[model samples]
Target: MDRVPQVEFNPMAGLRPAGASFTVFAELREQYDWFRSTVGQGFWVLTRYERILEALNDPERFSSSAITVLDPEPAYRWIPEMLDPPEHTAWRRLLRPHFTPASAAAMEERIREHCRELVDGLAGKGGCDFVADFATRFPTVVFLEMMGLPTERLATFLEWEDTILHRPYEPGRATGRRKALAAVVGCFRELIADRRAEPRDDLVSAALAWRMDGEPVAEDDLLSLCLLLFLAGLDTVTAQLAYMFWHLAGHPADRDRLASDPAAVPTAVEEFLRAHAITVTGRKVTRDGEFHGCPMKAGDMVLLPLNSATRDPAAFPEPERVDLGRHPNRHLAFGAGPHRCLGAHLARLELRIAVEEWHRRIPAYEPDPDRPALEHAAQVLGLDTLPLRWPA
Candidate 1:
């Protein structure tokens, strides 16, 4: 029998071409069932839908005590995600309601309003950098509003988010990220204090009042949760927005179909997510074992690109095509298993708003001819400059 092929994979290589990084995985997925890649600290690569889903499901063997692939020192110990079952379940119990479907539904109008304002900001202009003008605005602003944040100092959050996720590898970026992390936790502390004194209807206040194991949640625990929410919540949706907008701008057929039928917007959102799933997460192998013919040892890294699974041909017919009507879309864009994204309900609402509102106003937009969509990748990958022009 022939051995499976392995290629040295670099996560940074994905930054150059828009959505090119996942294509590398897709090629490997088609050529071989799995491959070995020098991703992050290096680990066996799983590109197939079943394999990636298997790892995410069997967290016992692939314990996610820490994310080894990105950042030698991760910005913060994100709750629930970085934890295993049982312990993870406890934290999730307290945090779920804040991001529940009901909660996200309640915030839909506010989110829609924010998206309209964002579109309005770029309306008269011939073109706008989707990343700068719109992509960054929706997630950060909505997050700020949802948490009862001032929304004026959104620049601070953006800076922190960029520092932590975009390029922590650059000199001084790691240090900046650590400082930014401290600042984020400090702000969360202040919010907790205020909520303790006079509880509001916001997430912070709700968290403060909540009891874990018949006692109030600990200070550090609350801070970790807040830090995670800020980092993960603001950034992932922002990146996805950039990719989705860039794709729809380029492909008029899908864009028109979605615009023509508002009801199809939700289904189109899933296809967009599947086609451009941005992140590639990691897991630490718990015990020495041969995983589906790949050699893995305890403490070894297992690079699980959610992008890989979502694009696997076995999972979706013609995985590359952005089929708006791809019903029963079981993509892992929001991840799977115990660590599935808590903000999924919020993200769906946000994505739906972005698609519906943007298409409503700028119905005939396309990628700017002069400047191409320049992309970047890390734990979260996306376009920073997606210039789009419409009929003026």
Candidate 2:
């Protein structure tokens, strides 16, 4: 394979306008097939739909050892996420039953109940910072309950979530990331110890009983898995919710479609997931190779910007249009191939319930003209603030 001419581009270092991440991705896809970003350690990016899918499916070459480009050579592994092949396969098998459609179905009622409780409180408020007041809290409650953690400390968990995920990377700004990660790990370590002693009927306890290759899963590995869940479970849905609502708030016709039909909410969820695909996961190059002309050496990081792939014009006709009834929406919102999101069913369930329940109560709303949605791009694209208003 011959090395190809590559442009140096940085996707992570920027302030994105409201819902402009998708626009930025569109331009990137039009301009460059791939580029080397010197954002963190430096990584190769695959922007086209076909190539991104190829890399995701071909994990043997594009290893999951380093899922984030920022920390290309991470000191710690997050269990299944950073594991490759058989190890990743085993973890997925263990986790599959817990996140199946039936499992997600079982939680729908509880999810709706939680969604309504939160939405009901906001019904009279006229307007609120939806990100703070609703988006973050809704999934955090459900996640805590699933993990068998005390929901009473919801505020504290939210704080830790903000610190670990929302804090942007700055040069010499390791303190916040390290401190937040330590706090989460320390908290999980204690939880693992407690679950080991008590052995309750929660996900943690279920994980405790897992065996890999006829051996009990190690305590350290358990902590790592829990850490992954903590980061993934709490953050992903919140980010999705932020973007979904932000879209709906601005586009009332889309909002009305969900409110009027009710049945359309499910498909609308899919469309929103497609249009506003948030996650930007990466892979580590396994050996010396060239992917479609770009040279990649062993230990080099490769970014799979899922958002860019989903909106590729080649894949989706009129890619930018948010068609609520978009059939055959094979978007990589939950990713593709061996490492597709385990909590995908749960995420869909949560998003469906959230849209259904919220619009049922607060039907008509729009983004506050004065204070706009604050958008950013990192490992995930999300709104830090979404001020929305309706008639009191």
Candidate 3:
């Protein structure tokens, strides 16, 4: 464990055209197995499929304490996502029942109905900003219903989402981010209070009964978990939907296949997820050791861009192209090992339903050439604007 190569890489660079992030990662994957990024306190980038997988699977060696490279030494934690091993296990156990395939299945028809309504409303518009009109709203409605939040506050939630996650982490946005975090924390505090005063048949009420180590979950822990759910629930699916539509809008053959043969949407969803894996998370090295031919030390941040694994030629044949029929597609899009996404089942169902419903209604569409879809690369890769056009 000695000298390490350094690269002037910034994962949180400003917005770029669609697929630019992937292209950058692809070049990095080709050249470097792992390199120390000279961005935000300096972190190692594990660029290969096997290296990233090894780090993700070995949570003991690679802690989830600070799941983002920018904030490797975060002042706070976000419940299950930032927790590791026993603590994370308990939280996952308590929350698993709510996000199981059965739970997602139970809400299938309702999800489909809502997705259809959103699609149908815009079917006649000839063109639309899919990110604003459908992508964000569809998941926000479902998440609000699940958490028992008021639908009337959808606009406010979107505003907070943008400020908290979508913005660049420059000094200019520092105050706005702090204020947004406080607002979210304040909102969750009120929700936790209400749920305690009177329980309801919702996820918030269910959290009141969660126990860790045979004792009631602490108030601070509940707030942390709620904060995690708030960001994760409202944010990830919206990004997934935008990326999926971005792909479908650009690739008509895949879109027509899903539209004509509805049964193909499921596998297509998996492929789209694999190709457009949207999260680029990080892990803090817990102890000093060498890994994947790279020198390591305790407290080092290792970046795990999920797309790097999903798009690795070593893992998937012809990784660049989207093959809807690809099988044994064990991509780390939802992540791997203990920290795998808790909402995976629900997300898959929602994406499947949204694809099915949208293509069924508006079978032919493409990205609006005048207004390109903008993508931001950070902890979570996201689409800012997706202008789509189709014949009325």
Q: Residue 288 lDDT in model 1?
A: 89
Clashing pairs in 3: none
Worst ten in a row by lDDT for model 1 = 67-76
The candidate scoring highest on TM-score is 3
The per-residue C-alpha lDDT of model 1 at residue 249 equals 84
lDDT by residue (1-392, candidate 1, tens digit) is: 14646577666553576766767777777777767675555566688889899999988998778664644445457776788988898888888878889988998888888889888878788788888888888888888877767788888888877776776354344677678788888888888888789888788887787788899888998888788888887789989998888888878888888788899998888888999998778888889878888877887777788888898888889988888889889999988889988889989999998888987888888888988788786777888788888866
Candidate 2 lDDT by residue in tens digits, 213-242: 999999889889988999898889999999
Candidates' C-alpha lDDT:
0.81, 0.87, 0.88
lDDT by residue for model 3 over 123-211, one digit each (tens)?
A: 99999998899989998899999998888999998899788887777644488988988898888889989989999989999988877
> Which runs of model 2 end up more than 4 angstroms from their true locations?
1-8, 170-172
> In lDDT terms, how accurate is model 1?
0.81
Q: Write the candidate numbers in order of decreasing TM-score.
A: 3, 2, 1
Query: Which portions of model 3 miss their true places by more than 4 Å?
Result: 1-3, 171-173
Report the poorest 10 consecutive residues by lDDT, candidate 2.
Answer: 1-10
Which residue pairs of candidate 2 clash? none
TM-score of each: 0.94, 0.96, 0.97
